[model samples]
Target: MGRNTRKRRTPLATKIVAGAAALAVGGGGLVWANFYASAHEEHGGHNRTRSAAAQVATIDCPDVGQQIRDVPDRARGEVDGELATMDSQITDAYQRLATTRRAQAGDAQFVGNSILGPLKERRKVIIDRIQLEINRAGGRADDNLDELAGCQGRPADQMQNGGGQNGDGGDQNGGDGQNGGGGQNDDGQNGGGQNQDDNGNGVAGPVADDFIDINDVQPNSRNSRNGLAANGDGGSTGTFTTECGVNENNLFNSDNLIAAPGVDNGAHHTHDYVGNQDNDAFSSDQDLAAADTSCQNQGDKSTYYWPVLRLQDGTQEFDAGDQGGGAEGNIGKILKPAQAEIKFVGSRQGDVVAMPKFLRVITGDAKSFTNGDANANSSWSCSGFEDRQVTDKYPLCPEGSQVLRTINFQSCWDGQNIDSANHRDHMAFVQEDGSCANGFQAVPQLQIRLAYDIPAPTVENGQVQNPYAVDSFPEQLHKPITDHNDFINVMDEDLMNEVVDCINRGEDCQ
Candidate 1:
């Protein structure tokens, strides 16, 4: 089926301006780096450039949720709630930093004194509560949690200089000269940061420098576990395709049932859901099992969702004034996917077993911009250029090609638990040789492919118009690297067995 070309929302020619300066503060330390703004000539003075160390683009806090190694099952709920609160606290602090450009420029210690300081204190309280919960539940909370409380004002340029991997200058974005546009890419991602001329547009970024022409990128090779191509013919090669309409029912929310189950707006960004009908932050296992589904097979009531992609053409969505929408900096018209493909396929090494019911898996990192690409697994490309994928940058497709976002869930699973303290420990990707390490068992991997018919954004004279970005936390700045997907297996035993059978037998089944 072809994408609907009719315009759902008209594109607007919006313009953005740049700021004169930027500030940065390192986490747990009082380090400041100012960005060199445009130079000016004083009265009878030479054109003196404003010297600066670097530009602090956003707040970089330790992901406390991912660091906690142990939490008793009884206390998991309380700990999760407190962790979600920490996320909200950071969002609040980031909002202050992003909006108070004038004040930040005036006071050298404004960010430290007013924003980060208060944020750290609030986080400390939350951490204390979290520690108490764990200790009360007989689980020893790590003493190191205190170290994760303080956050730094990370420099935008330093992030790009690090090449989208670890902040230690690792090349997770594929550093080969053919695709590595570190210099140009840096300008693209931070160009808008440097040009924080307005409060409205810069709040959600993919500035002119954040996108590159798809043609300019080289086709990179990707291999799945078991030493086979992602779709290679091998041991367990069959697939089960579930037809879930492209969110036609309009199921949307900002709550994350897997990571922050009971916390409202835990994601802090609107998500488009296409599988289970009754999914929200407060949903329980019984609730999901009994709920209706959008999938073609009623037995397959699994939940699948991701951040809604939006066009920055100045359209005010229904949530425009709401917390996870415009108010938190995610403004623009939401674009329903023209195509949403959900499939579960077998591992390359051998037949797969049924995934534990209610198994939750999250692929990619929503905070990859500040958290680094350790868990980032975003694949962005255009229709015709599917061979080329970029993890950190959005692709600028040529005419006639639609934008595509692909997410492959972790393919290996620990034999026991369906959930974990960090929500990720139970799941693991296959090792380099395509085999599960540490006694982990292989399960059918879920893959989601979504295509969007968005008007390609254009960059002219260092300014972008009609840029498209996924809805994200305010501090993330809407970078494509932050694109992610989530899934929860709720398939009944009979259907799950069928899926496993099909994959192991090398038969494509629906």
Candidate 2:
């Protein structure tokens, strides 16, 4: 054996194979034993499982670059509707103030009234509100907008960990959890939605079921009519009318007539209603389809009463624009102080000028003009040879001149009337006789009708109750015109421009 020791040893390759086989069998037996023990332990009221820490694997190669890209851009914006409403209100206030100063000359029914009026009080309130809005806008002017998802600084849906993002972000197993680890946060939540970036603007929410078309709105209206839906659309029982007293027979002939903003048919009366002032002008346009143009048949009255329409660019302005009933041959236009300025002209005594005195301007009454009629009495003028004075007859324009249908009551001759000596006063009748019970009295402008013509009151014992001055005119008007004693005049370029700016900006100026 010693002589052949190398040969006697087992072959090297053969020995290695035998050892591998034995090792495999031994490992298999151990694995089986372990499985059996675990199963038996569970059945015997004893169990062991991997810890949560053991289950969660460390996310390697987390793709940090792609994860960062998941964030949204900065988001925020302002709500335009609220801004517009406020702007309109502000503009209205400016216009009202200017109108009051000019129309009412800043005077009042009495001293107390001058201090407290709708325009004055409302204007103050609007100013305060505008200031608050401006301050709020300042905070959001430069904030990151991409994040804001709702009105104010709120988000549409809030995320765990105080951010708008949610889900266990790339925590483990490539789960659906985007941007974070999965599972709801253990703490209570505010449900605040998402945080808005800078600029009060946020992600838009779903609009309400009701919305209106703005283009279809009439001028001076907050209401809209377009986009209305009904159970059906086809035939309807409806009627419409305009300020000029339109009828169904004239539907075809009426110009500028259009569909009304809406129709509100009552049980007894069926008619169309316009929400806006400008839209109201077209109320009867549809109804006029059955009629013919009759303005041409009325002589020179075919044209406008004031010739104020646009005709400069080779435009055609004809009698067809007489839907307003030819302005009733008595136009009454009111321009607020913001639109036009009024100045007084006085007489001159020597080199120095002497201002004339006017009591107050009268307006709103139906003034008539009878231009071309002849009557008795002869002072023998070459044209008609009659003693008729200008005032006695409806005043006429000069020969071949057009009569002015509307006149702005700018200045005044005080509250006095020329009733020949025995003629009872006519100016005072409107105020005293109570004729205008249902009538509109030009409530927009500062106004005055004649003093009441009732018989002089009898004062008993110590005092007369009316407290009105006997001479009729008050001391306030007796002095020459000035800011304190005159009407508040706001008609100027600056004020008008301000109003226009606010309106264009879509602010709540009202």
Candidate 3:
């Protein structure tokens, strides 16, 4: 509600402790072994025998906890303070990368090399120093360094021997690491098998078959078509319309979309962003209010961003911790759609009303990596007047049609809080039958439609290779259908009044 003034703390130690607790409480030795094996392999080290032995024999919970306890409290505090500062620096670097201008061919690379690269190196050094201090205080240095540092050990020297290789020491298809290339199913499709249309055209991809189908899925039960307005008389009728044409001038990639509130770049995965000039972990209300905008309605300084949809060509590259490629070292090369169609549709339940400003809401949970998670609200279809839709995978557009990713946000507001603890409680989706919940007030519903001209995933050597996929950090849990968005209204008072008037009068002014 008020400005966030709390100091930031690094969660590495806590994560390690929680993990150790899980291992202890669950007595899941096999699970721990599997996790260690996975982590070991992810570093690209082949000497799994030695690594596994070291992991099991070198340190146990009692040993680590005692070692941690043995450290002089003052020293531990100093290390934490230093780590927090380093974390802040790293976050700032990523924010810089997200907001930097990418006007030239190599601009993305420059940002990676000049900003993210140095910060990552510095972070490695700090993490190493912390590990050494913990070891000096009687803890095994390697026991939890990876978790504590929030990074895999630097790839073996042999992996880095080739200078021009991608940063994670993986190939163009992403390395064989745990976070890479494992998204495909047995059929080689990303999520599900491709489907053929009635004409026998193999035009449907995993997303279409699994997640959404434009032909079957409706925006809401009441408004099945794209341009149709909401129905009902008890505040179901939309009064005013405003469209913001958001251009992708520059791109943003960061992990800080949902979890970390004020900390910039806190997400473990990368997200592509557009709209507001400043849209990272550190972005504050004041900063957003002051930042320039890419929307045609310059007065509406709202931020709209989502994970980048990557063209899965061999050229895609990933940064550290990113599961798939795209939006890592190459920022500018990722093409932007001609324009993003952002529309606000509100129902006039009562008198003309100006919606609250700075209302924050998130649609489609990014953490819903598993299929059938109630939060998975992603939808995909084809453009160019074609009719096909799918969920959980990319759509196979017909010839001459483009790909479309549509995300719709909840429109019923609690009419009080601008944000809730979960960033969602203040808002609820319109009912499946298209009525606002009883206690919630109907606000302008926000929907975003992104169009891309890309081909469908194809099978190569028994494995489906997608030329395009959604960019995700950390894991290829599902097809890039993990879509989410954010908005902050910065309209002038007069404009707000006009919007309320337009809506109350049942007029659609686009």
Please, what is the whole-model Cα lDDT of each candidate in the order they appear?
A: 0.70, 0.17, 0.43
lDDT of 1: 0.70
Model 2: residue 298 alpha-carbon error in angstroms: 38
- Model 2 bad stretches (over 4 Å): 1-322, 326-343, 346-364, 367-490, 493-510
For all predicted structures, in order, the TM-scores are: 0.83, 0.14, 0.54
Ranking by TM-score: 1, 3, 2
Tens digits of per-residue lDDT, candidate 2, 1-510, equal 000011112111111000011101111210000000000112112121211111111111111111121111121011221222222232232222212222222222211132122323433343344334434644222122211111010011111121112112222222212222111220112121122110111111111100111222223331111101110121111111111111112121111111101111000001111111111112332322223322222111110111121101111122111221111110112111111111121111101111111111222111000000111110101112112212111112124322111122222111332111111111111222222122212111111111111222122221121211100001011001100111111222343333334323333231
Q: Where does model 3 exceed 4 Å of error?
A: 1-246, 255-258, 316-335, 348-352, 384-387
What's the count of clashing pairs in each model shown? Answer: 8, 56, 21
The superposed Cα distance between candidate 1 and the true structure at residue 73, in angstroms, equals 0.8
Identify the candidate with maximal TM-score.
1
Poorest stretch of ten by lDDT in candidate 2: 30-39
**Model 1 agreement with the true structure over 1-510: per-residue lDDT tens digits:** 111111111121111111222232212111112122322222211112221234445777778888787899999988888887778777766656665555555555566667666677778888888899999999999886776666667544344322232223221121111221112212333342365422225444655556777876778743322112333467699999999889888887777888887766778888998889888777789988999899999999999999999887667677665567666767778999999999888877787888999999988889888887678788889998988888767888888899999887888899999989998898888775567788899999888899999878876544467888898887787778789999999999999999999988889999
Task: Tell me the deviation in Å of residue 37 in model 2.
Answer: 99
lDDT of 1 at 307: 96
**Segments in model 1 whose C-alpha atoms lie over 4 Å from true places:** 1-53, 160-202, 221-231
